[model samples]
Target chain A: MIREFSLNDLVFLLEALRWTVLLALVAAVGGGLLGLLVAILRTLAFRPANWLALSYINLVQGTPLLGQLFVFFFGLPLLGVNVDAWVAASISLSIYASAFLGEIWRGSLQSVSSRQWEAGASLGLTYMQRLTHVILPQAIRISIAPTVGFLVQLVKNTSLAALIGFVELTRASQIITAATFAPLTVYGIAAVLYFVVCFSLSQLSQRLERKYHAPR
Target chain B: MPLVDLADVHKSFGAVPVLKGISLTLEKGEIVAVIGRSGSGKSTMLRCINGLELVQSGRIVVDGIELTAPGADLNALRARAGMVFQSYNLFPHLSVERNVMLALKLVRKMSTEDARSLAHAMVAKVGLADKLSAFPDELSGGQQQRVAIARSLAMQPTLMLFDEITSALDPELVGEVLRVLESVAEEGMTMMLVTHEMNFARNVADRVIFMHEGRIHEDGPARETLSAPRTDELKSFLSAVLH
Candidate 1:
């Protein structure tokens, strides 16, 4: 159509960014809950539970994100589940985020000194009490940096949703580029929007880290 | 009944046996100093008494709780027996008062108000009353060790175990921590301590247990045991330590 690269196109891209933000939020919350379970299982001394968590982590981390998205988008129809692009993208991104977040959190939890456990035990704290009151508070501090880093990665990874015809930021950019014949302008603006999100996340993480680790 | 009873206690880490068939009894209000060379099972014996380490064979009964029984409630036993370590292991994230009060609130289920007052008193007892609001890293090693003692004391335990508590302190800082232990002894608290402080053993402890190669080489009145030894190992150990 060779339309003008106008304000309406910019508005459309901005609107598409809203979907990207929402998808990232859904993935984060879903992944966070599932990742907590994974981390606890991996850190526990029970062999069966540890093995189960390890295998799940390996399965998610070993496969490609695109393959997972494809499985959910295409494979679900074969199973008669009939999920749309939204469901498929959300599920696959969440699972992908869970494996990385789980491993990062498990490392943080275990990094706490063993002596701290003994100290808590000798003071008569129950296992759950020790975990909640002592271990988790310390581990939260250790986990902040890597966890935020993964979130930033997750935000950028939302672009992959466009491949499955989901109308997120990248897909919106492509639509605008085809109409206006302005690929450079459309993708450049899209890249800048991603930078804004990731940079703000990093800043927010630094503030949280400072707040938690500050001396009493 | 003895406050603590360890009968034919044996423990091993993987292939290496640490304590070999050790039998001991501690009467109420008795302060026993366990002295030995490194790797002599002194610390392990203290640890086993508090259920920190499991003994492969034999029995440990602390405050009438049978620790060797299957599914023993170790938390209950530990409530009656407090332990202090060489590194002080204070929850660094908490202030001195909170560190002392955490178990009181969580384990003892005391109200926050009650825990606060008890925390104050325990910190005062250790001569760290002024440092209540300070964090662990802000204090000197000796100060941190005193705070550790206060933290344990706040639990109102019947017996306390000290695992080389002053061994990690600077030479000058050792005196302050030992002084806290002396006052604790004066208050008639039953305590078992693994220590390298020979002089404190002679002066403060009611009994001395010298361990050699995972066995008790000598056990007797502290002054008597320090002055005159019964075994060649004890004589040599005393000479080597005293020198």
Candidate 2:
């Protein structure tokens, strides 16, 4: 039966949109923590740790996101760890985000002038003191724009979670369109919700860039 | 005991030797100027004393600490030996006050109030008391270099190394920075500087060590050496720099 795409359907989509937001938040926080570690390891002078970080970034980035989701979704069950789609989807997305964020932040850390380290050292600041007080503050300012830019990408990429039956915004839209046979209305609203989330992030990115980089 | 003692220090960048078996010493309160053509290792020698550059094989004892030892506490050594660079290197993100106060708070473990007062005093000494709140970019090149000096001075180091600190300044601005150095010298701070300023070297520095090809070619009283060069290298170097 082709029921109308009623208020009930709209509420369902909105609820699914909430899940989409939750997934992105989880991925960002998880990824951000892991990415910080990765960036530090990558930027350290120790070769073995640098190579380990680079290998992790390559492993995650080299594979397709969907492939990662599948590996976690199907592969986890094969190992007798019966995980749900949400588990699989969030884990895969976080790993995916970490690789890119790690690379972005590593570049930011390196972009700080090498002389800054020397200046800090000559002042008797310990290595950790230099990293935290002198280096990270400047690196964070440089990383702000690109880091938010990547968050937008992460939000949009959450749509791919629907294929694993995670029932996020896109998955809910699919169910609604199947019943109402209104692909245009269902997909259009989904697109707008994604736009709303992404546009706000980009706006925040610009505002932060201006605040941190303003000449004193 | 000498304030600084460098005995047979050797340093090379990869394959190219920069300092070749150099030995020198500085007494307390001595103002020594290192003058040489570029790549003659004047700057490298100053840096080696601060433990910024590790010598291949030598003994570097500064203010009673042996820097060439296998496990020397460089941070402890550096705190006692302040260095100002050619580029000023005033932390761009910090206000002048903060730049001067950073090491005081972190290394000296001073209370914030004490650091702030000392920062003010150091900035005044460098003649930038009015620009204490200004950022590095807002200040003129001379002002920024003065702030850099204040930043180092706030540490109350036993020795100060100035590596071509005025070489990057405009010719008119050079005198202001040099004047600040003169004041610092009057306070009886032990200073070692690499400079292209012949007049400043002659007037202010008590001793001039002229380097030629990674070796100290002449080390003598500044006025006598400047008036009568002992080596062809020193005479030619003076002509090239002054003319």
Candidate 3:
């Protein structure tokens, strides 16, 4: 049987692209803010605070995002929590991104030289004052490129959300393929959409990195 | 009464002794130059005064404030004792003016207008008024060091510490930095300098202190200590430098 590629299937995939991008943005912004807090606490907090932050990072990073999504979507109802697939996907993806981003930010913070701290302290700045005024400003410069690069990873990772039946781009492709019995054509379209989104982000990230490095 | 005093101060870093039974005093407005070979405890002694390096034993008092005490306000003490590092550790992200203004705004709680005016005056004092908007990486080594000096001066410290401030600069750049320091000393700011510039020690310092094996081996007036034949160590040190 000769099968025809339908414009209707293409339209469905294009509509699903909006959800994918929305989920990725929510994950990036929500996770980035929480990750900044975690990174700051991990580095600057005393014993118990540091321990708590470390445990949080370890728990998130140790388990798979798929497992977390399953727990949030399937397991939460058992505990009197009733969140739908979109909310579960957003929360799960955000937690997952926070772990990785937190680690990245902590490394950036540590990369700043000890002499900078000494200089700040010798100037009579309190610990918080030094961090806000001296250390974080420099660290933001060192961290920007890597942070933008991480967003591309975050965008691609949103595809995993399709496993929980959220009807994102990948899930929509599966539905279209099931209806028309044309797996290769539907999946190829989905792949191209993802490539376009992620490739553009990657290009933007590279441009930012170059601008940061360019001499004044 | 002495403006600064240390009584048998001792410091060790993981079993490596840096300062051993170091005791000294400086009157108010006195310019003391500390000279020693590398690893002879000169820098450690200066750091101990500002509580940057904790002393294992004995006491250090600055302007009647006990630095070795557990309850001392270290931030307050540091506010009074400004330090100039060899690397000119100005904040790279801040402009030269902001580098000078930071402590004034944060520690002193000065208003923005007052802080800006003081920072501007300080930048001019360092002879970098035109470079006020420049970042540390944009300035020459000497300019950066001068900005570092201006940053310290903005705090209006009672005492200043210099840890080989000019040693990191190019030879041609060294003189400009030393000239800024000389002007600071001439203005009667009390300073303790750890330096290799023998001529500066002889000309600008009120007293000269030589350290050997983590102890003060010689201490006296600058001219007598630098020029006269006192001990075999001092004679050999002078000869090594002069030759």
Candidate 4:
């Protein structure tokens, strides 16, 4: 007798896909805010603050996301910091995303011309005033396209959470495939779901790039 | 009291001196033109007066506020002095009106409605009334410079500094900007200009100073300096530029 794939199994995978999206949202929002702070600290003139921020960025980016998830999931228990799979996955993804996002934003902020700062100073604006009034507005325009593009990568990376026993889309597919003995069919559906979400985000980012190129 | 006074100003960048032992004084409602070769520190002198470039050793007083002192209020000093740059550094993201109104609203604390009306008037003065909504990139070089002038005028400063404002424009486009400046001079607005346009400098400036090797070489009436320069350097510079 041949083993069969059922609609009930596909439905469970679809349900888990929702959690994947929710986790991506939590990671993106949480990571984006923390990353902005890190970017600012890295650019500030204070010596110790700048070095501390750089060390944080280097540590997070040097380690692999899978390894980070492992630490957060398995190592936390030894320290008596017990947390559920969902909480562990979200926190791990947020840390992973913050490093990349912080670097990207720093590049954007530095891209503004030195002349803009000179102009602001000539007008006697303080450092913070110049940043808010003159520099950030221009830097934000240059940053939008790249920032949205990074969101797509963040969404796809959510699959790594499955390694830590999170029942997101990939984990759900693995469970179904073990029972049905149909790895190809079950994993194919999961790939399709991920592609749909990631592809839409990619298209949106491209459209924004084009719009930014068009004359105001 | 003189509106601006500089005593033995000295500035350098990384050991290469830009302005060395410069001193000058300007009374209210005076127009002085600063002339120099490309690297003679004419632009740096103008920048120092406005607090854009800090001097290493000097006493710079504008409207009785010592610019070189540690406790001086730079914003208040800048409020009374305005500068126009060669590149016409209007904010690209803001419209012409907002570009002019920014200092009015932010620095002067003018109400939005009042600042808007003042900005429109300044734009009209520069012959850009119809282009109030236009972005900086949409305008030509001359138009952009005029808008920059309007932006400065909106601040209602007591002294204006023009740093090679027309050097970046096309030859044909220079006249319109000069004409606006001529009318401004007629209104007795105190201005210190760094310019290469000898004719405009001769026609409009109350006094002209020739700078060389990071110091002033000659200072005299505009006609006397342009027609009968005292030194061979000024003579050769005029001959090469005019011919």
In terms of lDDT, which candidate is strongest? 1
Instruction: Give all candidates' CA lDDT scores.
Output: 0.94, 0.93, 0.89, 0.89
Q: Provide all candidates' interface root-mean-square deviations.
A: 1.6, 1.4, 1.7, 1.9
Cα lDDT tens digits for candidate 3, B51-140: 888899989999778999988888898999999999999998788988998999999999989999999999999899999899889999
CAPRI tier for the interface of model 4: medium
Question: Which residue window of length 10 is worst by lDDT in model 3 chain B?
Answer: B229-238
Q: Which one wins on DockQ?
A: 2
Tell me which of candidates 3 and 4 scores higher on DockQ. 3
DockQ of each: 0.69, 0.71, 0.62, 0.54
Cα lDDT for residue A128, candidate 3: 87
Per-prediction tally of clashes: 0, 0, 0, 0
Specify the poorest-scoring 10-residue window by lDDT in model 1 chain A: A207-216
* Deviating ranges (above 4 Å) for candidate 1: A214-216
Which of the two candidates, 1 or 4, achieves a greater lDDT against the reference? 1
Query: Candidate 1 lDDT, tens digit per residue, B67-97?
Result: 9999999999998899999999999788999
Ranking by lDDT: 1, 2, 3, 4
Candidate 1 yields a Cα-based lDDT of 0.94
Runs in model 4 lying further than 4 Å from the true structure = A1-3, A124-126, A202-216
TM-score of each: 0.97, 0.97, 0.90, 0.94
CA lDDT, candidate 2, residue B32 = 96
| Model 3, TM vs. native | 0.90
Cα error, candidate 2, residue A111 (Å) = 1.2
